[model samples]
Target chain A: MLRAAVEAGADAVYCGFQNATNARNFAGLNFTPKELQDGVAYAHTRGTKVLLALNSFASEGRFELWKHAAECGADCGVDAFIVADIGVASHLANQLPQQRLHLSVQAAASNPEAINFYCREFGIARAVLPRLLTITEIRNLKNEVDCEIETFVFGNHGLMVEGRCSLTNYAVGVSTNMDGACSPASHVRYERDATGGMTANLGDHVIDCFAPCDQAGYPTICKGRYRTPVREEPYYAFEEPVSINLMDMLPELIGAGVDAFKIEGRQRSRTYAGQVVGAFRKAIDAILAGQSPNPIDLIGLTEGHKQTQGAFLTKKWR
Target chain B: MSITPLAKLTLGPILFHWDAAAKCDFYARIADECPIDTVYIGEVVCSKRTPFFERHLPEVIERLERGGKTVVLSTLAEVVLPRERKMTTELCAQSDYLVEVNNGAGLGPIAGRPHRIGPTLNVYNVQSMVHLASRGADHFTLPAEIPGNVAALIGAAARPIGVGIEVQVFGRAPLALSARCFHARAHGRSKDDCRFVCEADPDGLQLSTLSGGPFLAINGIQTLSWGYVNLGAELDAMCAAGICYFRLMPHRTDMVTVAKIFFDRLAGLSSPDEAGACLSALGLGPFENGFWHGRAGHLYHTEPEH
Candidate 1:
């Protein structure tokens, strides 16, 4: 993706170690220490920066690994560290004072007051705002917050409050907050129903199911289909199977003073990553050049082959 | 050896909206009869609902104080608006009560002042605990879904610093909070025009799975576990690990009896199994203590003999 991103005129690329250090700790992905060293060299040579993603919450006993992740990237001359846990932030602030820190969306620092706390104490240069914030809220937050604000512009839409959700933890033993997986494939069971439907079971519970020939999404408890006995209908009570595509909302976000555009799906393949980065790259550059953002045709990679502007387009309560 | 404090029963701030009369009547009962040692009084969920119950705050505090229960006021979990920020600031400024911070926004408001940590703020690791301790936090309630061992480990780490730890031993555990009001959305209303609909479900409106299984509850901006997290059986384990406070989140049930069961189990007057049965008889949905075993929080596994 480094070459693809640079070739696609990207200014920066964010990736993480293959271990449990980042939020998307999928199989056969992320970089080793040597790979990171080489990747940083490669990206820096092309005037494109490489930011290390150590965004997962690091709990007790595993503090050393998270701390090592910070040291590993800092030694590799990486541009910045996207951190979530206060423990990880504390380590980066005290030990690697020179390394620039960006508060991860996993920190859930939505409001300016909360974001400023991290900036004042941790010296964070940027904060990836939680997807929960509306454009108006983001615009309002930018006026008061100290650090640069980043918001998700495309890819998977996580409806739950970032950093604080336990819906994954309750149904599955692992959670993104504690364990770096949400409905991780290890525990997910796909079974064929008598009616020729596929049920995505997270452990013992059926999170969501799909009819035959219907595209199925990863079983996340919040975005799953559910039924209340009082209501005869089974619907996506929390959120539908949709990826957020904010290409149409770029100017509004830019006007709202969003410093960076984050593309979700580090869990996707490298080819998938490059395509998304390249697509968003063209759209953003066009917008920057005072031209209308040309919509990128990338719906095939979406959860249900559908995309939404999500909370961005919603008229939030004043 | 460090002194392990006897786990005292405490009542958390009411998360659901209740009318002033019912709210007063409930606190009156808690103040008059319940064996809880502490009572947290204030609106931690929505700031708009605070005014309806604000006038009765002093009387409730006075009544609880007279009943020999320590009362602490709690700030809202999420503060977005300018008024919410001012409200949070004013809540922390109160000289009469020590504010329990539900969000990090309160930390700045209560700077250098002794405060308590609510479950809404993530106090997962020892470093976060130590960080909050340095900022004048005297007590903490670990998040509802955190592993029991992690809570105990945090409690142990906090003991030396003179900070107390609390575990939510009962009630529908608060699972998540959002800026958007899910309760309002379920009713086809925006948050501003919510019309106080959350008051209808005193326990909270349960969100179920496609299989007709009750999964979670929607209480305005917060999503809660449908199963009341009754750790009556695990009180022995939590108390042994230096937890000083046992928190019971208020629900529309016979809480005095609920308190008695936990109190009896803690006092050695009843076995945990018996306490569990009595708690089950209360009929507040299902019960879960799976978080204690470090497994799926919704799944139940009997405590294996250590």
Candidate 2:
């Protein structure tokens, strides 16, 4: 699936180590050292770049682990490193001066000054923009900054603070920034309530309860519904469980100087990755060729059986 | 062993609404009475509130500086408009005070300058911290959810690079910031035409779960933990971990007393128990330090030193 992504249209295939060195650190996903070496080789052979994700924050007294992971990734002959930490990025840039570095979206370098600083000091070649940008803001950022820009085109729409937010950790004791998992599956449990509805609980928090007819996604704190003083009823306080589909907005994003479009699931199955990557590849190619791309049939892949353009379509209330 | 008096106090930007006169009076009082070392002033929640405080900022900054406070201008948590970006850029260019890049929109203009990374910036690990420090960030205010161990590690790593670390100490913790304003939506108004109704609840409206348990608070688009976070007791552990600064976010209550409680704790004049008792008298709520101890943020895992 990764090889196909490179061959189809991807400029770079970003993957993470199996451990907590990356944000998508899940139970049965990501690459080992040997797997990363083989993956890099496969992409290199096909003239595609391999970007290693070491984006998760290194915990106290555990800096050496993240440092070693970077060294191993460099040894694997990866094309570039996507990083969020200043300490890690600086270490890699100082040790491997010739290696390319891309600021991970987790870094949340949303402004030109921040991007320029990364480029000048650590030689960052690209930055994965946070999902909070408007089309006009992207154009302005491109004009103000020298490095390449990447945007998320599909997957869970993260509306919280990118890179720095720890709301999940506050709620459930795990966070994507430190632990590389938000509302991790280990803490999640589903049980049939007295009403015969399945209640999904993350830690002690009941995130959602669904009837037999309802579809469910992973129980995340931000996607959970709650009753607020302003609203008399329970509604999504942060954001609804929705996937970001920019298939229709591809031309606009591309025209706004977006250098790359990122697909957000590394924990996804190889089949899911291949299908989404292939569809986006075709859509992007069609747009570049001045033809209207066919709408992607991605309803089956959506969470809660729904999708939205998220912040890209302006502010959402639900 | 006594903890060293190395904990620096920072005043976070006011996240609530106040009249221009009251806002001016707040800073005036901080300048005259608060023992805080740094004061962050500017609109962090909504841009509309910026205009109200904008006219008073220059004077307030002057007063703060006269009182020997290192003033900082903060940026909006969510920046979706071109004007908002422009405002961030202008604030960044104000060479008189350091800038706190709360969101990514503010980073571009102030990159490679001596700036403070706000909690909203979501810096969870050493790599992200080092990245910001290399970009001329001399200091960082970690996200509220960062565990003490992680904070200590980041602080230790940052020490060699000559970067300072600050953690949120008092006030309702800021959980999330979004483009949609629940305060306006609740009042049946759009964000574009929000009637400045957030002023109704200076400390944010408390939210309860469906079962009537306290869950969170809503201040505009931001979702905050309903429990106030008081780290007066964690000073020794944090100081041992190499943290140099502790931030107390502004609240509607007695901020001077809040600052004094921390000051007294640091001075050994008051124990963590005494400080915690005083915190209750200030009328916030039950306190929690679980997130600081690497537990649930809302859970009070550590027993207070009563």
lDDT winner among the candidates?
1
lDDT of 1 by residue, A185-287 (tens): 7888888899999998888788898899986678877778776533557766667788988888888988889999988746776677778888888888888
Candidate 1 per-residue C-alpha lDDT over B183-251 given as tens digits, one digit per residue, 9 for 90 to 100: 677766778888988888898887777666788888888888888787877877887788879999898
TM-score of chain A of each: 0.95, 0.95
TM-score to true structure, per model: 0.95, 0.90
lDDT of 2 by residue, A228-249 (tens): 6666677766667888888889
CAPRI classification of candidate 2:
acceptable
Give me the displacement of residue A302 in model 2, in angstroms: 1.0
A44: Cα error in model 2, Å:
3.4
**Candidate 2, residue A18: CA error in Å?**
1.5
DockQ of each: 0.55, 0.46
